[model samples]
Target: MSLVARAKSLANRDALTRVGLALTAAWLLLVLLFWLLGPTGTTEPSGLGRLVRVMGLVLPLALIWVGVSLGRSIEILRAEAADLRQQLGRPLGQDSHGRDAARAPMPAPTARPAAPPHGQAPAPAAAAPSAVAARPRPGDQRQTAMRFEPGQAQAPIDVTTLIRALNFPDGPDDHEAIDALRQALRDPDLSRVLRSAQDVVTLLAGHDVYMDMLPPNPAPAAVWRRFAEGQRGSGVAALGGIHDREALETVAQMMRQDEIFRDTAHHFLRHFDGLLARLVPELDELQIAVLADSRSSRAFMLLGRVAGSFG
Candidate 1:
């Protein structure tokens, strides 16, 4: 459905919107009475004059309150509608909980007896592959798109496979791999590790080395493990292909040690180290504003606290 209809449906369901509508009606009635029965000329100040005078003093304040309430109600409706859109846009086999109908483990196929000629007994059939097992693996379908779910644990970044893809003759323009990496970046849990590796990949592209050239040397599995563990030194060395060793090391160190890293990691990584330090606090402000309702945001608050404990 269209956003307006979706938003209206949400607003109609909200008690606060009903209250706002009542306040708006009251405000409009006061304005109409003041205009219609107000004293036109000096008549020794009648009862209507006194009533209009009192309403004149209260009308502006009441109108302001009504406006604020309606504005907030509309904003809440818009946010709910946007969330509905996200839910509706999910893939056909996937639900809002991230469960995939097609990803469920399949049972192994059993052998079937074969028909024999005339009255002869039938021979047993050979074992067959399961539905899931019959599906193509990465080796067979390298161009398959990746899926990202923010609430779930991310699969480990496959640097070896990524490097191999980058070294293809048409690697620079390997849209499938690039799209997969981009999709992976949307996972907040994997952003720190994935972004660092992506920086190295972006650097390689700038040096006339499209997917056709190697990254001088493949990073050892130990480096990737240390990266997954949030270690500073090994992670920096693992990304040596970036050319600017000193700069990468500095950013990595700050990201690992800073108190506000969890709150501002996305922004700092997007920009440089010192460019937007003040902006880090803004994330906390936004979290507080959005989490004002304890019931609605308790899970997110708990998750943030747990993630902070890791640091």
Candidate 2:
């Protein structure tokens, strides 16, 4: 048979096999019930026993057949997946002549409408490409607010750099870095990462983690002012002492997700890092090492390594 014919036949066979598997499963269950309800006495010489014995033999064969069918179906699926991967990996819009549509020169833009037949209150001009290019970037805008979209392209988190940035004294430089990091956290894509990290922080906070660690500000204004002025009185020892297993697991999971989603989880946790820096602007490598050694978990160990890099 032709390759296409064989593929079609395999697809049909797979569908039929699936349907048969469901029906056979139901039949097997019914047979099992019948066998269970059969006579209990060994000396009975009952017809039900004989019937069950025959079914027992038949059931094994049926199961073996089903297994083989499933195996065949899986093989067919694997083959199909391989084919699809190969096709998708090829350049888009490739023709029989092997020309790449993407590389083809684009057509010139159509000419604009002629000058509106002598100024009957002339039509509005379309904005030129140069005008668009001259517009300020979002980062340059004074009122720029962080916005997150769930499906935006993700970049990996630079764990070492992030740790150093977070540990930096709260000066104008660190404040700008913190603002950028906070904006990154507001991204919707990091929602899960944020929640997970927040859960860990909250769990630790429940144990009075930040009670003595944070500044004893009389008001919110004081807190904000302290953060703005780059104050650095608190020591790194204040950030240490957390050793909870559950919280460690949560942190580990956040790190794993950061690895998978790249910067997604890492940026999300930057919010916490900034908050910690605000609480202890004088945190040094030794203090970071103390926090890192608070638990033997992989997360803490990784944090320790990041902190040690600064030394």
Candidate 3:
């Protein structure tokens, strides 16, 4: 079934499960009444025959209720499996199977990606192995991309591209998002930030900690400006407006116990911090708010809170 139908089916299944449980409860109540009143006064079946009748009536419903309980547990297990597969860089959905084709990650492009003319789709990027997907640590002594700065590059990617790249592509068919990300990847520094942000957010989803759950208490433009102007610590802490303590604690716990997660989180933080420091100066308040609403920005907010970037 299509995902939309599958989602609706799950919803309908939940309702059916609830109704079945309620019916099972009603049957139990009737059983209690049968025992209390005893079949002496009425035509109600009694003795073993009556017990047989009750069992016949209750068994199917009881079975359904038990199945529903187990189904919920199975769903949890399924979600965790999907999360693990995703973390291992395996495809979670059918669309993800083609993500490598759509992404076409390369170490360096043969030609610089110029912005497509307005309203035209971007040309297909040349196929290359995904270099950014599995990045090496800085300690590996391999140089990584760091070529972007505010007003420094000759052909800077537009804010829309930045926003789209931050959100990343939805799936293989999300051509617009894919194209924007492709454009962003042409810049060394921006690409690293995008990849790092992508890794941490994907990891966070495994913990069932999503960016949307946090009430995005967006800091004012002045607060964002302070952050862009090289302020650090409490002076610009409001930028980390995400206040979901449960999520913060989950990330904090991960940071403590999971060495790999901690390292990735710190790497992502550094890349995002550097990129934001450069990018924000060029945007207005409205644009800043728009950027903040993107998926990557939400991840940054959550991680910053855990890392104490926001006081």
lDDT of 1 by residue, 48-122 (tens): 978987897687767767776677767666665564445334322233343332222222323322211111112
Which TM-score value belongs to model 3?
A: 0.53
Each model's TM-score?
Answer: 0.27, 0.23, 0.53
Worst 10 residues of 3 by lDDT: 128-137
Which 10 consecutive positions of candidate 1 have the poorest summed lDDT?
A: 128-137
Residue 206, candidate 2: Cα error in Å is 52
Error of 2 at 84 (Å): 2.2
lDDT of 2 by residue, 65-154 (tens): 777687777666666545434323332232222332222222232332321111011233242211101111122112111222344434
Off by over 4 Å in 1: 1-9, 13-22, 34-218, 225-311
Q: After superposition, how far is residue 238 of candidate 3 from its true place, in Å?
A: 1.5
lDDT of each: 0.35, 0.36, 0.62
Judging by TM-score against the true structure, name the best candidate: 3
